[model samples]
Target chain A: MKRLLKTVKNNFLSVFFIVYIAVGMVSVCKPQALNIIDGFLQSDRSLSYLIKAPVLKLLDIRYGGVNLEPDIKLKAFYIHLNRLIQRVIGNDYIYDAGPKNDVVRLNNGYLTTCLPKLTD
Target chain B: MLFSSTVFLFAFLPVVIFGYYVIFRKSRLLQNIFLLIMSLIFYAWGEPKFVLVMMLSIIVNWALGLPAAKYRDNKVRARAVIAAAAVFNIGLMFIFKYLIFTLENINSVFGLQIPVPQITLPIGISFFTFQAFSYVIDVYRNDGEMQKNPLNVGLYISFFPQLIAGPIVRYQTVANEIKNRKETLSDFTTGVERFIVGFLKKVMLANTMAVVADAAFDAKDAISPSFAWLGALAYTFQIFFDFAGYSDMGIGLGRMFGFHFLENFDYPYISKSITEFWRRWHISLGTWFRDYVYFPLGGSRVNSKARLVFNLFVVWFLTGVWHGANWTFLVWGLMYFVILTVEKLSGIPKKEGRLLIIPKYIYTMLLVIFGWVIFRAESLGAAGEYFKAMFGFNGGTFISDDTVFYLKNNLVMFVASAVFSLPVAPLLRKKLMSAGERTRRAADAAYTAALLLMFVVAVSYMIKGTYNPFIYFNF
Candidate 1:
C-alpha cells in the first residue's frame, strides 16, 4: 500500500487518472451516476451506440414514452419506399446518394449503398 | 476487439483486470489458465471463426519449436523444420491475404477468367503469423530456449497485448516472463496512465483527422489542391497517432500483465532524413528484419556494392509486402528503397550544417507525406488522381470553401496535434521535476484533471459510435 501511495504521491497525472478511474468505478457501482451522461446522449444504450455523429445528441425517435419502442413506422416506410424506387427504376438502376443505402439498410454484400459503387 | 471500444473499455477490460487480479491473484497457475482463456475469448470476439486459425498457429508453432530446438546441432534437419515452419506461416498469410490479390492481377494481365476467391482477411493474421514465425525461428537460432509447455508457448504468441497490432515482441524478450511474472501496483497504475494517454490520442486526434482525410479522398469531385494537401497532412498525422497510439496501449496493457515489451515508436516525424525516420518508426519491425533477415543476407557487410543493394532491396521489399497484400504497399516499400538508394549513391552527408537542416526536414516530410498518399489510397488509380490533385497537375482551384472551413474549425486540433506529437509528456516531467513540490503537485493535478476531462469527452464521442477503427487494423 505504501508503495502504491508513494508512486501516486509523486505523479499528478497518475493521481488524476486514479481518481478518474475510481470515479468510473463509482459510477459503475451507482448506476444512477451513469445516468448523468444519458442526459447528454440517448437514454437507451443500444440506440446511443447506433448514433454515429461526433456529438452526444439525443436520438430523436418520434415515439414518446417511458418504455422505448423501435421506430417501426420509419422502418416500414423506408422498406416500402425502397421497393417502390426499385420497381420504378427497374433492374440495374438506382438513385445515387439516396436514402436507400446509407440510412435504413445494413450492408449485406448484394446491395451495399456505401462507397466504391463500382464492384471492380 | 478494438482497445478503444466501449465493450473493451467498460466490459472486457475491467472484467479481465478484475478476474486476473482479484480472483486468480493467489494462484499463478490459475492466473495463467485464466489469461489464456480470456485472451482466446478476446481474439474470438473479433475474429470468431479465425480463432481456430490462431489456435492452429499456436499449436503448429509450439509443436515445431521443439524439433527446431532439438535439431539445433543437426544442420540438415534443423534447416528443414525451420523452412517448413516458415512455409506454414508464410503459406497461411499467402492463401488468406495474397491469393485473391495474386489471382486478380493474373486474371487482369493474362486475359483469363480465373474465378476470384475473395474472402475478408482474417484480422491480425499478419501480426500473429510474424509472431509465430519469430518463435520458431528464434528457437532454431538458439536465441531463446524452447518452451516445453504448449500453454506457455500459446500465451507467448496469443497474449492479448500486441496480439492484433504489435511491437512484435521477440520470443527471447518474454520467454522467461511466460514462465514467471509478477504484477505490481506501481506497474499497474503506470499502465493505467499510459492506456489513458493512448486512448486519448486514438479517440481525439486520430479519429478527428480521419474524418477530414476520408472526406478529401472520398470526395465526389476532385477536391481543391489545398484540400488534397490538407487531407495528406491529416492522414500523415492519422497513421502516426493511430498506429503509435495503439502501440502505447499495447505496451501499457503488457505492463499490466507483468510483461515489459519494448517501445515501438520514437517520434519518427521529428527526424531530419528518411533514414532516421525508418529507424524511429516501427523500431521493433525494423530490428526484427535487421537481425533475422538482413544479417543473414550479409547486411551491409557484403564485399560488393551489388550484394549490399540486393540486401537493402530484399529487406525493404519484404517490409513493404509485410504491410499488405496490395501492390501499393509493395510500391510504398520500394519507394523508400529507391529514396535510400539515391541517398546512398548521391553520397551527400545526411548530417548537414545547421543552416541546411530545415531543408532536410522539409525533404523528409515531403517524401513521407507523399508516401502516405500512396499508402492511404484505395488503388493505384486513386493514388495517381490524389497526386495530380496534390500537385495541381490538371488544375482545380487552389483552395475550397470546405478546406477553409475545416482549417478554421480544426485550428485547435491542428495545433494540438503538432505540439503533442513531440515528446511533450517527458518534456513536461523534466521541467516539472525542477519546480517546487507544491508547484509540481499542482501541475500534476492540472494535467490529470485535463486528461480526465479528455477521457469523458472522448467517451461521449465514442458512445456516439463515430468511425473509430485503428488504421493499422487493415495491415
Candidate 2:
C-alpha cells in the first residue's frame, strides 16, 4: 500500500499533465470556429493569412493604424497559438483551399507573372 | 505500394498487421510463410509482370550464394563467381534503365541510325538488385553465412517494407532476424509511433512543399531568382522529407515485425559540411559503397595519386548513375565528389566548439540547396538555367505577382518543413529519456498522444489526397 502511494507521488506531474490536456481540450472544443481556425493556421499558410488579415484589421480599428510588419508578427503569433489549440483539441478543422487557388502561389508571389498559362 | 497511397495505409497495412499477429500466435514458421506470401502479393500489386523479373534475380542469387559459400576458401573461383553475380545484376539494371540513354548517345556520337528503344523502367529495380548482389558478395567474401533455407533469402530480397524505396538493408543486418526475432509490446508501440510520425511527415509536410516545387520546377525559364530559390528550397525539403519519411516507415514496419533496421537518416539537414552531410544522408547506401566498392579498390590507403582519384571517381560515378539514367544525376554526384575532394585536399581544420557550428551548418545548407538544382532539373542545360536564375543573373525582372501569391500560400508549410527537417524529435526524445521519473512519464504520454493525433490526421489526408509515389521508387 505504501509502495503504491509512493509510486503515485513520483508520477504526480504526469497525473497533472493528463488533467491539464483534458481541460485544455474541453476548452478548445467549446469554440469550434476558433479551433477550426487554429487547425487551419497550423498547416495552411494562405488560410492563416485570410484569418489574420481580417482579425488584424479589426484590431487596427481599435488601435488606430497598426504597422504592416508588426501585423505580420501578430498574425504569426495567432497561427502559433492556434496550433497549440489544435494540439489540445485533438481535432483538425482547417479548411483546404481547393486546387483552383494555388497555395504555392500565395507562398511565392514572385513567380506569378513568370508562371506559364496552362492550355490543356 | 507507395507509402503515400490510401490503399497502402487503409487496406494493405491494417490487413497485414492483423493477419501477421493472428498467425504469429500460432507458429513461427507459419509467420515467415505468411510474410513471404504477403510480400509477393505486395510486389505484384504494382507490377505483375516485373515480379517475375524480381523472382528470377532472387532465384539466381540464392543459388549462387549457396555455392559461393561452399567454395569460399578458393579465392580465384570465388572471385569469378562474385564477378559473374555483379555483372548479372548490373547488366540487367543497365538494359532496363539505361538502354535508351546509351543508344541515344551512341547514335548522336557515331551518326548511326540506331533507334532508342522505349521501355518502362521497373520500379525499385536498383534497390532490390543492390540488396541481392550484396548477399552473394557477402557469401563469397565469408563476411556472412549463406542462408541454407531459400525462403529466408527470398524474404530478405523482397521484404516489402524497404524493398521498394530503401535504406538498402544488407544481408548481414537482417540475417539473424530472418530466423529469430520476437516482438514485444514496447516494440509494437514504438513501431506504431514511428509509422505515424513518418506518415505525417510525408502527407502533411512533404506533400505540401511538393506542390510549390512542382510549380516552380515546371515553370523553367520564367522562374525569377526569388521564386527559383523558394522552389529549390521547397524541393530540397520535399525530397528529404519524402525519402526520409518512407525510410522511417520502412524501419518502423521492420521493427513491428521484430527486426531492428539501422537508422538511415540523422538530421542530415543539420550537417556541418558536405562530407558530414553524406555521412548522415542515405547512410546505408554510403556505407555499402564504402565497404564493398571503395575499400576493395584500395580506398584512401593507396599511395598512388592516380589510384586515389580513380577510387573516388568510381564511387561518385556509380553513386550518381545509381540514382537514375540521367546526365543531371551524374553531374549532381560528380559535384559532391569534387567538393569532398577539395575539402580533403585543402586540409582545413575541422571546425570545433559550439560557436562555429552555426556557420558550418549554414554553409552546408547553401551547398545542398545548390545541389538540388541539378537533381530537380530535366536536363544539364535546364539545371544550368535554374542555377543562373538562383543568382539573379537573368536580368532581375522576373519577379511577378503570381510568384508572390504562391509564396504567401505555401509559407506555413515551407517553414514547418524546414523546422521539422532538423533533429528536433530525436533531441526531445533524448531529453525526455534522461529526465526525472515524473518528467519522463509526462513526456511519454505527450509523445504518444501527439503521435496518435498525427496518425489520424495523416490517414485523413491520405484518404482525401491523390497517391504520390515515393521519389526513390524510380531509383
Candidate 3:
C-alpha cells in the first residue's frame, strides 16, 4: 500500500500532463478542429469553380516554375502511338473493333496542342 | 548522382566497381585512396566549392577528435574540445540551412528589412551535419577510438553511397572497416543483389508513382474524395520507396566497398500506430536522435514530469526542423510529438495483439496517409484545402475522368507497389531457405535472373530521362 502511494505520488505531475494537453487542445485547437473535419467531409459552396480548377491545375503544370513541355509532348506522343497500335490491330480480321477514346476533336485544347492539325 | 540515372547505372558505378576489384584488389591502401578520390569527385561534380566545405569539416572534426583523445585524462579541456567540434559542425549547417529562415522570421517579427542571404543550401548539409555530430559525440562519450588518418575520416563523412541522402552512417560503426576490411566475392554478389533491388524500387515504383502523385496534387479541378485519397496514397508509397530505396542502395554500395552499413528501414507502413511507425521508419535517424540527443537529456530517467516533457519536446522539435526550414515541417514534427505524448500518457487502446489486428492497421494507415498530405503540401492553407477535398468537403463530383483514367492505367503498378511495400520478398526468401538444397539453388538462380531483368528495365528508364531526384535529397 505504501509502495503504491509512492508510485502515485511520483507520477502525480505526469498524470496532470494528460489533462493539460487535453484542455489546451480543446481551448486552443478545438474551434478549428470541427471546421477542418467538416471541410474534409462536407461539400464546398460552389459549382462554378469545378471547371476552373482543372484549367488552373493544367496551367500550374505548364507554368508552375518547372518546365515540363517535353514530358507533356512525350505523353501526347504515347497516347497517339497507343491509338496507332489499336488501329493496326483493328485491321486484323480476327480482332475487328470499333475505335474508342481516340477521336481527336480539333476544338479540344489538349488535342490541338498535342497533335498535328490536318493541313488540307 | 542518382542511383537510377543512366550515367550512374551504366557508366559511373560499373567503372568504379570494376576498378576497385580488378585494379586495386591487392592493396587495401590503393582501394581506400581510390574510394576517397571518387567520393570527392562525385560530391564535387554537384557543388565544386562545397566540396571544400566537406573537406574542412573532415579536417576540423579529425583535428578536434584527436586532441580530445590525447587529453582524455583532463576532463575540462576534453569537454571544451568536443564542444568546439559541435559548434563548428552545427554552425556550418546553420549558416547554410537556417540562415535564410532566421532572417525571414526576424524580418517578419521585428518589422526589419534585413536582406535574407540568397545562399543555395549545400547539398547533403542536413545529412552530413548529423553524421559529423555522431563522430564528435562518439569520441566524447569514449565509445569509439579516434581515427588517426584524415583520409579515413573523409571517407567516413563523404562516403558517396549515403553521403547525399542517408541512413546517417556513424563513424564508430565503420571505424575499423575504414582502415581494414575485406572485399569478399560473396559480399560483392550480395551487394549487387541489394543494389539491383534498390534501383528497381526507385526507378520503377517510386518514379512511376511520382507521376500519378504530381498529376493528382497539381490538379486544379475540384478534388473528389477518391482522387484526393488516391493521390495521398500514391505519395505515401512514393516517399517510402524513394527513401528506403536510397538507403538500400547505400547499404549495398557500402558492402561492395567492404564497409557494412546497418539497414535504415523496415516496413514502416505495416505499423499499427504512429509511435510504432517511428520505430520502424528511418530507423537510423530515430536511433541517432535517441542516442545523441534524447539520452543526453535524461530520457525516461527524468526526475520530474516537466523535465520529461521538455526532453520529448526537444527531441521532436529538432526532428521536425531537421527536415526543412518551414513552419509546416515544424508542425508536422509537433503533430507526431503530440500524438506520441498522448499515446505515452493514455496508452494506445487495447486489442494490440495479432488476432483482430485489422482495425489497428486501418487506423494507423489512415493517420499516416493524412500525415503525408500535410508533409507534401506547399503550405498549411494548401494542406487545409487538400484535407477538405479528401473528405469531399468541396462541392465536386466524387469521380473525375482523370481519376478513372489514371486508376485504370496505373492499377497494376499500384497493386505491385502494395505487395512490395509489405515483406513479400522476405517471405519468399524465408520459404526458399526452408526448402531443400536444390530448391534453394533454383530460387537463387531465378532471383539472379529477376535482378538482371530489373537492372535492364531501370537502365532503360534512366536512358529515357525520367525525373529521378530523390525526394529526401532536398532535406
Candidate 4:
C-alpha cells in the first residue's frame, strides 16, 4: 500500500493529465458537456477569441465556415470531436454539406470550380 | 489504431498503463497476460476480425515452437518443423499481402482473365508474422528459451508496442525480460519523454512534410524542377520521421512496460555511403534479413563474385517485395542492390579517405532521395515522369510560384527537420552530462517543460484534425 501510494504521488501529474483527457473524451461524446465547455469559454470574450480565432480561420479555409451555427459558440470544437468519433468508428462523415471550395463540378464535360461561399 | 490518434492517446494508452503499473505491478505473469489482452484490444480497435488472424498465428507458432525445440537433436524432424513454420508464416503473408499482386501479374503475362480475390490486409500482418517466425527459429536454435505457456508466446508475438509497425523485436532480445524484468520510475519518465519526442516528430515534422510531398507527387501535370526536388526531399524526410518516430514511440512504450526493443534507426540520413546508409536505416529489418536469409545462404562466405551477387539479389528482392506488392518497391530494392553490390565489390566505401566524405555524403543522399521517389510513386512510368520533371526534361519551369510558396511556408520546419535528423540531441545530452549539478538540475527542469509543451502542441494538432498519415503501416 505504501509503495502504491508512493507511485501515485510520484505520478500525480500523469494522473491529472489522464483525467483531463478522459474528461475531454467524455465531453466530445456528450453534446451537453460541449455546450458547457462552450459556455465556459464564452465567459471571457478575449480569451475565447484567442482560443477560437485561428480555428475559425482554418475552418473557413477547409469548410468555408458552413458550420458556424448561431447556437454553437464552439462549433469547430464540436465538429472536430464528432469527426474523431466518426473516424474511430471507421466512418468518414462530411460535416459540411455547404459549398466546398476545393470540389470541382463537371458541367457538360468541362470542369468548373465551386466558388467560395459562406453559408452561416 | 494510429499512435497519433486521439483515441489512442486519450483512451487506450492511459488505461493500459494504469492497469499494468497499478493493478498488476507485483505479478509478472499476470502483467504479461494483461499486456497480451490489451494488445489484442489495441489491434481489434482497428479491425475486429483480424484479431482472429493474429490469434491463429500465435497458436500455430506456439504449437510449432514446442516441437521445434524438442526435436532439435533429430535433424530431419527439426528441419521439417522449421520448414513447416516458414511455410505457414510466409503463406499467411502471401495470401493476404501478395496473392492479388501475383495473380494480376500472372494474368497479364499469360493473357488470361483470372479474377483476383478482394482481400483486406490485416494491419501489421508482416510485422507479427516475422516476429512469430523469429520465435520458432530462436527456440529451435536455442538462442532463447521456449515458453511452455501459449499465452506467454502470444504475449511475445503480439505485444502492442512494436506489433503494428515494428523494429522487428527478436525473441532473444526480450526472452528474459518477458519473465523477470524490473520497471523503474526513471525508465518510465524517460519513456514518457521519448514518447513525447516521437509524437512531435510524427504530428509536426512528418505530417507537415506529407503535405508538400503529396502535393508534388499528386499533381495532375508535370511540376517545376524546383518543386519536384522539394517534394522528393520532403518525402525523404517524411518517411524517415514517420518510421523513425514510430520506432521511437515503440521503444519508449516497450520501456514503459520494462521491455526494451532494439533500435530501428540511427540517423540514417547522415550516412556517407549507401552501405553505411543500410547499416543505420531500419536496422532491425536489415539485421532480420541478414540473419535469417543471408547467413543461412552462406552470407559473405561465398567463393565467387557471382555467388555474392546472387545472395544480395535474393535478400534485396525479398526486402523490396516485403515492403509492398508494388513494382515500385521492387525497383527501389533493386536500385539499392545495384548500388550496394558495386560498393562491396569495389571496396570503395571502405577505401575512401576523410577528404571524400562530403562527396560521398552528397552521392548517398542524392541516391536516397531518388530511391524515395521510386518508393513513393504509383508505378515505374510515374516515377520516370517524376524524374523527367525533376531533371527539367518535361519542359517544366525551373522555379515556379508554387515552388516558392511551398518553400516559404515550410522553411522553418524543413530546417528543423534537417537539424534534428542529425546527432544534435545526443550532442546536447553529452554537453549537459558534463555540466555542474545545479545546471544539470535546471536543464532537467527545462527538458520536462519542453516535453510538456511538445505534448500540448502535438495533442492540439490531433484535436485540430491535421493530415496525420502513417507510412509504414502499409508495410
Candidate 5:
C-alpha cells in the first residue's frame, strides 16, 4: 500500500507531463495527417467511390446531390494520411490503376458520377 | 486584433505581455499609458478613420462630465450636460449604424428617391459609446466622481480587450480600479487559465461548428429538415461558445491588468425562462440598460398601465437598436419584450422540485434556438425559410450524408465543448479545496498542466490559421 501510494504521489506530475506531451504531439501531427489524407482522397478512385457511395446515399434525402458524410470525409482523410505515410517511407501502397475508375478519377468526376446516380 | 486571431495570439499578445511587464511592471500610471497606446493601435488597426470618431466622443463626454462634477447643486445644468452627452453619443451611433436602414425605409414607404449612402459602421461603436455615455450620466447622477485624469478615462473607454465586445463595464464599476489596483500572482495565474479556456472554446469547438453551420445555412435549398435542425443547433452552440469565449477572454484580460470587470455570462443555458435567460445572458448589457435606461424611464413604478407598457416598449426598442442596425435586431428585441410581457402576465409556476429542471432547460433552449435563428439569418424571409426547414415542411429526410459528415468530423470537439461549457473546473476546484490538502495540491497540479496543454494546442491552432474573430466584435 505504501509502495502504491508512493508511485501515485511521485509519478503524478510526470504522468501529467507525459499526457501534455502526447496532446502537444497530436496537435502538431493532426494537420499533417489531414493534408496527407486530402492528397489520397484526391488520388485514389476505388477508395473515393467506396467513400462517396454512403455519402451519395445520404444526399438522396436532400436535393439528391449533396451526399457526403463528415465521417466518410474523416475516413477519407485517414486513408489519405496512411497513403501519405507509405509514400514518405518509399512504399508504393498507392496502386496506379491505368485509366479505369481510379479514386483520383472518381473523385474528380464526382459531380457527374454521384449526382446522376443519386437522381436516377 | 481580435482575441481569437493568430496575429493576436502569436504576435500581439506576446509582444504586449512582454512590453507591459518589462516597461510598466512597477508603475500603475505607466501601465495604463502603455495599455492605452496598445489599445489605440489595436482599434486603429481595424478602423483608422473611426479612431477620430472615438476620440471626438471621448472628448465630448469628458468635457460634459467635467462641468457636472464642478456644479454640485445646479440640477438644471447638470441635466443639460447629461442630455447633451447622451444625444451626441446616441446620435453618432444612429447615423453610422441605422442611416442606411432609415433611407431604405423612407424610399419604400414614401417613394422617396433617397440613395443609400455608403457608410462603414465602426466596430464596437455602440459599446464604447455606451461606456462613455454611462460615465457622463453617472457623473451627473453623482453616483461616482468624474475622472480627473483624461488618459485614465481614455483607457476606460478604449480598453482594447473589452472595447470591441463587452461586458459593458460601467464607469463606476471600474472607477476605483482605474485609480488603484494591484496585480497579484494568483490573479495572473487565474487570468492565464481563463484566457486559455476561452481560446480553446473558440478555436477547438466554436470554429469547427461554424464551418458546418455556415455551409448548411448558405445552401438552405439543398438542406434536409434534419440538416436544418442540426445547422440551427450547431449555430446555437457556436454563437454561445464564440461570444462567451470572447467575454471570458475580456474578463481574463481585465484581471491580468488588475481590473475586475463584471461577469457577462452565467450558465445561461441552464436558465428556465426567457426572463431568466436575459438575467443570465449578457448580464452586463441588461444591467446597464436596467440601471441607465429602464429605471430612469420610471421603470414599473408608473401608476398607469399604458405608461408601464410604453416604458417597456421604449426600453426594448432601444435595446434592440443597440444590438445592430438591422430591422431583424429590432424585431428580435421586440420578440423578447413580448415574450417577457406574456410571462409576466401569465406568471411562471412556482418550482415544485428538482424534477422541473429538465423541462425548464428544454423551454429555455427552444426559445434561445428560435431567437438565434432570428439573430443568424440575413433577413426575415431567410429566417422564416430556415424555421420551416427545421420543422420538415419541405418533406426532407431525417439524416443526410452532409449531416453525418459534420457530426463525424466534429464529434470529439462537440463533446469537449459540452463538457467544458459547464462550470466543471470551478466545481472541481471547490470540491477539492474542501476535501483535503493532498487533493487540493493534486487539483492545482492537474489544472496547471491542463492550462499549459490548452495553451499549446490553442497556439498550434492559431499557427495553423483556423482562428476566427469573436462573434460580438461587430456589436
Candidate 6:
C-alpha cells in the first residue's frame, strides 16, 4: 500500500492528466459521435451502403432528419450544427434542379438527401 | 493543429500521451515509431495531401545526409552534396512559398503578363525545411551522426510539438535522445506546469489582445491616433504571447518526452536595445541565421567594413524574404538591418550609463512596435495609412470614444499581459524561495494550485471556442 501510494505520488501528473483527459474525451467526443454517424450515412463509401438502408428503416426517419434518436433538444442542436457544417463545406450554394430522388429540403433552403450534394 | 484548439487539447494530445506512456513504455524504438506516426497524423489533420510533400522532404534529405556523411573526408564532394541538399530544399520552398510572388513581381517589372500558378503553401514549410537542412549540415559537420533509418529523420523533422510553429530544434540537440532517452516523473510534472502556463498565456492574454488589435487594424483608415497606437500595442503583446506561448508548450511537450529543446524567448520586452532584443526574442531563428548565414560569411570578423556591410545586407535581405514573400516583411527586415548597422557603428548599446537605460529601452520598444506595425499590415500602403493615423496625420482625432471603449474593455488584460511579459513571476518565486522552508513549501503548493486553476481556465476558454489566431503559423 505504501509502495502504491509512493508510485501514485511520483506519477501524480500522469494520473491527473489521465483522469482529466478521460473526462474531456467524453465531453468532446459525444457530439462528434453524432456528427460521425451523419457523415457515414451521407458518405459515398461501399460500407456506408450496408447500414444506410437498414438504419434508416430501423429509426424510421427521413433521410434529411437526425438519426440515433438523440433527445428532441439534442436533435435540434445537432441539426443546427449540421447546417453550419454544410454552409462551411459550400453545400449551401448547391440547389436542387429536380426532386426525382428521395430528397427533403431543409429550412435553410439546402437539400438534405442521402445522395451526395452537387457541390462535391 | 493549434495548441489552443479543443480538438488538440482534449483528443489528440491525450491519445498520444496515453500511447507514449502506457502502451510503449518498455520499448524506445516502438515509442519513436509511435511518435512519428502520431506527428504525421497531427500534421495531416489539416491538409492530407501535404503529407506527401513532407515525406518527400524526409526521404530526400535523409538520402542526401547519408552520402554527405559518407563523403566527409572528401571536402569538395561533401561540399557539393551539402550544396545539392541546400538547392533542393530552397527550391522546394521557393516553388510552394514564393513562386507566385516572384512571378507577379517579374510581370510588373518587365511589363509581361506571366501566368502565375495559384500555390497553396503547406504549413510549416519554412520550419521543417530548415530542420532538414540542419540535419544534413550537422551530419556533414560531425555535430551529429547520420541516421541510418529514414523514420528517425522523419521524427526529428516532423516532431508534432515544434513542427508547425517551432523553436526550430537543431539536429545536434536531439540526435542522441532520438535513439536513447529516459522520461522521468519530475520532467513530466514540469512539462505539465509549463504547458499550462503557455496555454493560459495563449488563450487568456494573446486571444483577448487579438480581438482589440483586429478591431482597430480592420477598421483601417478610420481609426483614431489613440486607437491606432492601442492596436499596435495590442498586436505587440498578441504576437509575443502567441509565439512565446507556443514555444513554451513545445518545450514543455519536449520535456514530457525527455527531449530538452533550448529556450526560444527570454522576456524580450525588457531589452534595452535592438541588439539585445534580437538576442532575447525568437532566439532560435536569430541563432539559426547567425550560425548558418552570418558566421559563414565571416560575420563581423571581416577586416574590411565594406565586406562586413555586404554580409549583413545579405543576411538581413534573406531574413526579410524568409518571413514571407511580402514587401512589408522585406521592408521590415531591411528596417532592422539599417537600425542594427547604425547601432553597431555608433556603439550605442555597449555604452555604459544607468540613466541611458530607460531611453534605450523606450527606443528599442518603439522601433519594435513600429516594426510590428509594418509586419502586421496587409501591404506597404496600408502600413503607411495606419502610421498616418498613429501620428494623427490622417485627419483623425487623438482620443476618441472608440479608443476609450476598447481601452476600458481590455485594460485588465493589457495590464496583465504587460506584467507577465517581464520576469515578474519568476522573480516573485525567487523571493518566495528565500523566505523560509515552510513558506517555500506553502509557495510550492500554491504554485501547483495556481497552475491547476490556470489549466482549468485555459481549457474552459478552449471549450468556449475563443478567438485563437496563431501569428507565426504563416511563417
Give candidates' CA RMSD values in order: 10.8, 13.4, 20.0, 9.8, 12.9, 9.2
Question: Model 2, chain B: what is the TM-score?
Answer: 0.96
lDDT of 5 by residue, B329-374 (tens): 8888998888777776566634556888788778878988888888
RMSD of 1: 10.8
Candidate 2 lDDT over B346-377, as tens digits, reads: 64427587888888788889989988889989
TM-score of each: 0.82, 0.80, 0.80, 0.84, 0.79, 0.86
Best by DockQ: 6
lDDT of each: 0.77, 0.75, 0.74, 0.82, 0.73, 0.83
- Candidate 4: regions farther than 4 A off: A1-120
**Cα lDDT of model 1 by residue, B59-174, tens digit:** 99999999999999999999999899989999999988889989999999999989997688887888888889999999998888798888888888888889888878899888
iRMS values for every prediction:
14.5, 14.8, 23.0, 11.5, 14.4, 13.4
Which candidate would rank higher by TM-score, 2 or 5? 2
In candidate 6, chain A reaches a TM of: 0.28
> Ten-residue segment with the worst summed lDDT in candidate 6 chain B?
B458-467
Output per-candidate TM-scores for chain A, rounded to 2 decimals.
Answer: 0.22, 0.24, 0.28, 0.27, 0.30, 0.28
True contacts kept of 1: 0.07
Put down candidate 6 lDDT per residue, B1-475, tens digits, no spaces.
7887756876778889889989998898899999999999889866778999999999999999999899999999999999999999999999999999999999999999989998999999999999999999999999998999999999999999999899999999999999988788888878877787888888778877887888788883477899999999999999999999999999998999999899999999999989899999999889899999999999999999888888888888888988999999999999999988888888889997989989999999999999999999999999998998999887856898778866875677798899999999999998997899999878876777677755765564454333567888888
Error of 6 at A100 (Å): 35
Q: Model 1 in CAPRI terms: which quality?
A: incorrect
lDDT, residue B397, model 5: 79
lDDT accuracy of residue B258 in candidate 4: 86
Write the residue-wise lDDT of candidate 3 on B1-475 in tens digits.
6666533543356557767878987887788888889888778756678998888888888888888788888989988997898799879988988999999999999999999879988888888878877887777678777888888778889989989999898877887788788876557666766776888888767876786787778777677888888899899989999999899988988887888998889899898877889999999899999988899899978788778788889999999889988887888889888887877666784445776578778978988888888889888888899999988899778897767856765676688789999999899999999999999978876776666655655544543433676899888
TM-score of chain B of 5: 0.96
The regions of model 5 sitting more than 4 angstroms off are: A1-120, B349-351
Candidate with best TM-score: 6
Off by over 4 Å in 3: A1-120, B349-351, B354-356
